[model samples]
Target: MHVFLTTERLGLRSFTDADTDDLFALDNDPDVMRFINGGRPTSREAIREQTLPRLLRDCPCLRTRSYWAAEEKATGTFLGWFEFRPLDDHSPAVVELGYRLNKAAWGKGFATEGSRALISKGFTDLAVERVTANTMTVNAGSRRVMEKAGLSFLRKFTGDWPEAIAGSEHGEVEYELTRADWQQRR
Candidate 1:
């Protein structure tokens, strides 16, 4: 497996065709899909046709895959994935950070650890000026992880969701860490 990044206990690597089954299981989990799709089941066809292609796509600015398959570094267990893609295909000035780990990995420090590593890499190596993340306002767990990773609350806004989920009424929140802010923190 081509590893892209690694934390103390987690490895982030490029997604491959072999990951179809793992992606299916992660998306099919009710708890995992709750905030994303209101616990709806994702068809395997969709994973192969849509999701996998997106995950495997290369970012023009970075000239590399932006979404990574995360796994346990030691045992190589498939955890989930992380995205640190540039918002604009041609510019590395701003990127969006995201993570989706399996239920088994929930509440573990893996999220914070991986997030911090990605942010540090973006600011120090990728020419990234800012890193941003967003989630539903009710997603306290995700928000906490963002905070722990050193991002500060930027704003709250309503997104155009085709199908509003359970906590859509409360809107969404954004958190960000600029290169300057990250440098100061260090």
Candidate 2:
């Protein structure tokens, strides 16, 4: 298995077929899924047949080093996943950063740690020009993680959604960090 990146307490690795159960459990939590699917549990069949396959296909380090399965390095337990890939693979200088951790891993700095590491890799190693991330405007927790990872608030925008959550009417917020900005911060 290809291990992509590692944070102080988390290991980001390429996802494999064995990760289906861990992904299923993470997606099944109402609190974890709240911002994603409005607390609706993803079906097991979808995970087994679709989700895991897609993750495995997209996350290989050899191709893009995009999606990653986050694990607790100390215990080797699956924490969740992180994504840092270009909006278009053809133009890899601009990428988007994202993560989804289990509720159990909340408030532990894992998100920020993993994010900072990925952003560092993008700018210092991957020749990334800019990194962007977005979340529901009401998702203060995620927004905080973005801030702590050194991204600055960019804008708020509305998107067409098939399922409306409690804060969907408020739109979403975008945060970004350019290579120049990252260099200045360093």
Candidate 3:
């Protein structure tokens, strides 16, 4: 397995077929999927078919790639996963930073911690110029995570949301950190 980066608390490595159970468990949590699918659980088939395949493909995938399971370095427990990849069809230097951890892992700083590492990597290692993340406007927790990770508010744009949850009408908010902005933050 290709290990991409590791921080004091997380080891961000490549996903493998062996991560089936880990990924499944993460997506199975109701709260984990709340914003993603109106709390509807994700099917194993969906992870296997739709999500995993896209991540496991070769790099420069429209200028995106998946890192590894965010394992707690001390325990080797898979808290979740983090990614830095391009929003498909978008130009280079534009990447998305995302994370999905189980409910059990919430409020423990994993999201912000792992994400900060990815942002640094995006600017320094991947040579990415800008990184963005989005969440429902009401997802304060997620928004706070983005903020703590050093991203600044970029915009609030409406979209044809699939599930149209409570906050969907408020539109989705995009937070971004450019290489220059990231440098300033650092």
Candidate 4:
């Protein structure tokens, strides 16, 4: 497996075709998908056709895949994935940071750990000026992770979600960290 970055506990690596089973299990968990799709279960076909394709796509600006399959460094268990994708194909100035871990990995510090690592790399090596993330305003767990990772609340707005979920009425929130802000924190 091609490794991208490693946190104290997470090994973020490039996704492989062989990860279909792991991806399937992670997406099938109701709690895990609650914020993402209102607990809808994803089919294996969708994992292969849509999810994997998107994760495997290369970011022209970074010359590497934007999404990374996150796993436990010691056990090598497939936890979920992390995204540090550039907002534009040609510019590394702004990237969106995201994470979707399995239910089993929830409540741990993995999300914040991986996020901080990615942010540090973006500011120091990836020429990224800003890092941003978004989630339903009611997703308190995810919001806490973002704050812990040093991103501040940027905005709250209604999203054009194709399917409205439970908390869609509350709208969505955006959190961001700029390179200068990150440097100051360090």
Q: After superposition on all CA atoms, what RMSD does each candidate show versus the true structure? A: 0.6, 1.6, 2.0, 0.7
The digit string of per-residue lDDT tens for model 2 on 1-186 reads 889988789899999888888999999999998888899999999999987776776623325558899999999999999989788757668899999999889999999999999999988888789999999999999999999999999999997889899888999999999999999989
The weakest ten consecutive residues by lDDT in model 1 span 1-10
Q: What is the full ranking by lDDT, best candidate first?
A: 4, 1, 2, 3
How many residue pairs clash in model 3?
2
Deviation (Å) of 117 in candidate 2: 0.3
Against the reference, the lDDT scores of all candidates come to 0.94, 0.89, 0.81, 0.94
Q: Name every residue pair that clashes in candidate 3.
A: 13-68, 64-85
Candidate 1 pairs with clashing backbones: none
Q: Write down the worst ten-residue block by lDDT for model 2.
A: 56-65
When 1 and 2 are scored with lDDT, the better candidate is 1
* lDDT digits (tens) for residues 113-159 of candidate 3: 99998888778877678899999898899999999999999999997
> 2 or 4, which is superior by TM-score?
4
- Model 3 sits at a Cα RMSD from the real structure of 2.0
- Please identify which of the two predictions, 3 or 4, would achieve the higher lDDT against the true structure: 4
lDDT (tens digit, per residue) of candidate 4 on 31-71: 99999999999999999999999999999999898999999
- Estimated TM-score per prediction? 0.98, 0.95, 0.91, 0.98
